[model samples]
Target: MHQGGKFIVVEGGDGSGKSTQARRLADRLRDAGHETVLTREPGGTASGAALRQVLLEGSLDARAEALLMAADRAQHVTEVIGPALARGAWVVSDRFVPSSLVDQGVGRALGVDAVEALSDFATAGISPDLVLVLDISDDVSKVRRASEDPDRFERESEEFHARVREAYRSLAAQRGWVVVDGNLEVDVVADKIWSVACERLEP
Candidate 1:
């Protein structure tokens, strides 16, 4: 392990299993003699959770929603993530700025550059050491998402998801993220995520 805490981010479209993989990765890190903190975007703290509900409110405009997410991220980073990292504890986030870059930036036509700038401000200089992008087909994502209540983003059309996926791929290529196929079984997907996390965490 390194001197500072490792920040690992997992991102994907709805039903891509990001939450599941994040939890598993946290467990793996804990078992490997390291302290770990598991968190999620839009709801990592009390204020963030409150903002999350507003962000999910059906009446908010797309741009408004994006701004709310930014606000939540800023609070979460300052109150939760930064403190955890300062303690040299590994932080595994189920979703991070990448989600906004895809869903709000590309899918909502907000422009990726604008999204990136907002993310930078919201994150307050913290950057993930490694980002695991779980890529799955829209069909698969939709089928899996069907089991849950359709959020505003999930209710978007298939074309929207395609654009979001493309944005994720492009972002990964530009940012040196590790792209993983999310169509595999839960354990199989976790193993691949574990491998990449281990590679980055080992000194």
Candidate 2:
């Protein structure tokens, strides 16, 4: 509705319904008459799609993972997010820099500040207008992914997921991102997300 559109991101642990909640919010925003663009990290664009598999499935050290994540974000912003926001279309992303911050930064023991600097360079200071961090426990994350073959990150031990969860909570609080209970029912979580969006961004 404004000159430059808003950028909103949904983040959480595995099986935290990030994709579902992101789509619902994007749809809701579109229904409200805002031009919305829904996308995700690791595969939001042509090049990113190619990187997605390797990033999600490949065995890489923390530094390598962080670099790849940043590269994906760079392309994602340059190709998809930048143009949409510049043209006044809202962008709703499932995951963004925060994923790298928690996953490789904390979970992989690379440090948040280090990954953040990398992310900032990748995004070129194009930060989200609003960030919705969905909080869920490691057990919930494991249960949700039990039926499917695990990805590189998912295959990590329970301790890794626990650390990732804690990092997300801590960093989100430090950054002023809205924290939502992802363990709630989908509809309930969606409603909460909508309310927070309305309350904070009035979108």
Candidate 3:
């Protein structure tokens, strides 16, 4: 049987540098001879992009937000992620199910178990082979976001961000996720993530 491609997920808060690291990992993997597809949640597909706008810009109840995220995820996996993996292209995503678990589950106080169940159904059982969580302090996160136009989640109160960070830490510990210090310089953080990805996914 032909071996399918690996699925890797990079997760973190708004300013935790997940996008940068995800791109770096994908680039490194491709340079090393592996076909790589670098994508992001809430907007990986056309339909997903529409849903992302509603979820981020429109004000909705927590339940509604969670459901929208699940909806986007379903399309993302079906349309983009699954096909790439089937073709033996490594899929490196900026955010995956973990975002729903933290944002809606813990941050929104919607319950992690329920959110996880929804996420499982959304992705149709597709899960990341390796999850790299860029961990950063609340202070660092705030500093990083200060210069940018805050998004819906970024504009959330400090308590909410704190909850999200703690939830990430808890999930990382329980799930054996590879956590990197996002507080470091971009290149340094990327190097650490690259080292782990090479060892686990490429080696």
Would you estimate the TM-scores of all the predictions? 0.95, 0.97, 0.97
- For all candidates in order, the CA lDDT equals 0.88, 0.91, 0.91
Tens-place lDDT per residue, model 1, 14-128, is 8899999999999999999888999999899999888877777557877898899899999989988888888999999989998998988898899888988999999878988
lDDT of 2 by residue, 1-203 (tens): 33599999999988899999999999999999999999999899999998899998887777988898899999999999999999999999999999998998889889888999999999987989889999987778889988778888778889988998898899988999889999899999999999999998888
Q: Give every collision pair in model 2.
A: none
Shift in Å, residue 41, candidate 2: 0.6
For residues 42-63, what per-residue lDDT tens digits would candidate 3 score against the true structure? Answer: 8999999999889878899999
Model 3: pairs clashing at backbone N, Cα or C within 3 Å: none
In candidate 1, list every pair of residues with a backbone clash: none
Which TM-score value belongs to model 1?
A: 0.95
Residue ranges of candidate 1 with Cα displaced over 4 Å: 1-3
What is the RMSD, in Å, between candidate 2 and the native fold over all Cα? 1.4
- Ranked by TM-score from best down, the candidates are 3, 2, 1
| Residue 63 Cα positional deviation in candidate 3, in Å, after optimal superposition | 0.3
Which 10 residues in a row give candidate 2 its minimum summed lDDT? 1-10
lDDT of 2: 0.91
